[model samples]
Target: MAATEQQHERALEIFLDERPELRIELDHLNPLLAQAKGETAAQYRAERLHEAFEAEAERLGLFAWELTLQLTAASPQDYQAQRLEVHKEVAEMAGMTWADYCQLHDL
Candidate 1:
């Protein structure tokens, strides 16, 4: 049970396979929250899932992608160091842990 570059790739491929649905989920994650009473300000997160995918894809020189992101906000000056989390849905399907996720991404 060794993890290799190909295994890493397969993990990411699983993510890309569900990318469209993931994008939709992000947009609809909190419809109830959006409709909840009393909040004067409306907060909607930007839909940059595509861009994030594209950037990583291009940067890695990979045509098809297999990765998902959860954001990180570090500090005022460390904005760029806020590397996004890359998920592969093994969390739900395979009962993968956060530690596993971190290990997979070399965090």
Candidate 2:
């Protein structure tokens, strides 16, 4: 027997959740991951999954940088300012600076 539409959607969600990297692939995944009947469908799913992974990684990186900046924005004393400076330097070294990352990603 064929699976119900709800069944298909639930299965797709489970599949994507198992591979969090593919969550971004939903834009091209037809909401239900569709029925993979042949090679082309498989290839399309793979491509979409890859795109999603890249997008999500970039988003997380930007979010981390923004959070760091907000948390360090209230340094009133000299020592606090020095510590914030050190944190910013470390984040830059790790390639997590908000301005640079956003510019690079065209975001």
Candidate 3:
């Protein structure tokens, strides 16, 4: 798998933790990865995985920003600051300011 795919997969795994029902949805996702033999196919498969993840997230009333906020809120004060800093760095890498990222995601 590509690094990006691995990153997304790892994220999805984290999100699925403690949720067996969500883990089952991953079974539907695995075949797509296996079938992706070339760059174009892999990209297409990645998009499908993204769509699937979004659908499942919506069904569970989960949002990326909400999850991030929950994690930050649950962290120790020192860790919370570190997490926010990391989040801002990630947002910048994704081509958005931290404020814009929060706004865009309704954080």
TM-score on alpha carbons, each prediction: 0.22, 0.27, 0.34
lDDT string for model 3 (47-104, tens) is 6556656776577686544343333343567445644665676687899977898887
- Of the two candidates 1 and 3, the one with more favorable lDDT, higher being better, is 3
Q: For model 3, give the 10-residue run with minimal summed lDDT.
A: 65-74
Q: Model 3's lDDT to the true fold?
A: 0.56
List the candidate numbers ranked by TM-score, top first. Answer: 3, 2, 1
Those runs of model 3 whose alpha carbons end farther than 4 Å from true positions after fitting are 1-9, 14-39, 65-107
Model 2 Cα lDDT, one tens digit per residue, 1-107: 12334543454454467775556544456533444444465566766654554464467663333323323344446434544565556557777976775466554
Candidate 1 Cα deviation (angstroms), residue 17: 29
Steric collisions counted per model:
1, 0, 0
Higher-ranked by TM-score: 2 or 3: 3
lDDT of 1 by residue, 42-91 (tens): 24323234445557666775422232211112353332232332234434
Say which candidate scores most in lDDT.
3
Kindly indicate the candidate among 1 and 2 with the higher TM-score: 2
Name the top TM-score candidate: 3
At residue 81, candidate 1 shows an lDDT of: 33
Q: Please list all clashing residue pairs in model 1, or write none if there are none.
A: 12-66
